[model samples]
Target: MRRLALPLAACLLLAGCAPTVSLTPAPQATAVGCASLIVGIRGIETIGDAQRRQTDAQGTAAWGTPASVTLYCGVETPEASALPCTTQSGVDWLLSESGDERIATTYGRAPGVQLITTRDASVNDALETLSGAVATSTRGTDRRCLADPGASATPSAIP
Candidate 1:
């Protein structure tokens, strides 16, 4: 009877320590996935983890193309705790997307990215406008970018 109680307690203890999400496999985000283009991120200004270089490049490549992309980066240090480790811990953390950010504010990663690949003749001349819109919406304080998180995903009028 006592042994059974101990095991149950241990199980409960471990469960409490773990986040609702999985922590294994090191989350190799080859790209940040976001459906809506209006409210999601477009491109990352910079990333923290060097390992994500491939993924980052893949995201950047989507520019003016027909693909949406997201990139995340952060410091996952050994000598400290998780995201609570502060923004300037000088360590690499796990970066993810703003897709979940809209729902939960705690799903913080190092620096997650979100982008949409849609058709728009404006993509050629108004690249900054699009990129800025997404960025300001997700990470910035601008709501114009947040108006329709999935708006840019509309089919390209180019054809």
Candidate 2:
């Protein structure tokens, strides 16, 4: 009974340390690339382990209470059609918004990335913190948001 008790306690301890993020794993085909993305993310700005959630997905991360920021490492590439693309911190992200949250992803890149952030959060800061990781972990392309010929402010791109 003593030996059984010790083993049971160990099992409980391990379970307690398990990841709490509840992400659905990406498809097996994309898992490998997703795994690569996770390997590069040693840390994210202002986010700690306690804030991270356990995800079932192969390559995904979440932060903040109730997860104000959620990121998926590998997703299907976006279509070539004209979508609102924005470039920041040397990264090109196709933007989409619903309610108070915004979703952005690397435009025209394989092993795609998706970042979700609440409106209250600083999108620029999030982009700055994540762009380097996304650029390092995935493939990139020449495609970008077309510059407005008449607009005075030209968009910036990371070389």
Candidate 3:
């Protein structure tokens, strides 16, 4: 019994110290307008225990067993050169590809919000929930991903 007790206590101690996710810190500036935006927003899917610890990243939310979907708030606004924007739920998102993950960011908002999710994950649900939060956070601008003439404004799922 004594031998088992020692191992059991150690396991419990280490379990509490384990980190849920490893997040890469993103570049941040004075995020005065969007600092508190994360609090008002909630996850659309089954993502739980959302947390962000990056120095400049204002906020981050994660979901799934291995964290398939991650959202970062207070990211630096994307440059004009990054094109191919998609409008989802009234917000225009600039899409970028990184390996098997799709990164989407709001086009015109200062201190933009970023979403990093697996290719298989559904960003539409998340964007739906975040649109209002982002709209209220920053001032509007005219920059957007150019839409093809007569093309549907709605963008397909990330894949």
Candidate achieving the largest lDDT = 2
Show pairs that collide, candidate 3.
none
In candidate 2, where is summed lDDT lowest over 10 consecutive residues? 150-159
Global local distance difference test of model 1: 0.27
**What lDDT, from 0 to 1, does candidate 3 have?**
0.64
Model 3 compared with the native: what TM-score?
0.68
**Which runs in model 2 stand beyond 4 Å of their true positions?**
1-19, 27-31, 45-50, 148-159
Q: Per-residue CA lDDT of candidate 2, range 1-159, in tens?
A: 999999999988885764476876544326655667777765653543225555566678877656777888767765674546676656678766678887777776667888877754555556777788777777777666564534312222211
C-alpha lDDT values of all predictions: 0.27, 0.66, 0.64
lDDT of 2 at 58: 66
Residues 55-146 of candidate 1: C-alpha lDDT, one tens digit per residue: 22222222211222222222121322232111111111122223322100112322233222222322222233333333332232211211
Order of candidates by TM-score, top first?
A: 2, 3, 1
Q: Tell me the RMSD of model 1 versus the true structure.
A: 18.0
My TM-score estimates for the predictions, one after another, are 0.17, 0.70, 0.68
Superposed by TM-score, candidate 2 places the C-alpha of residue 10 at a distance from the truth, in angstroms, of 15
Query: Which is the leading candidate under TM-score?
Result: 2
What's model 1's lDDT at 109?
27
Root-mean-square deviation of Cα positions for candidate 3 versus the true structure, in angstroms: 6.0
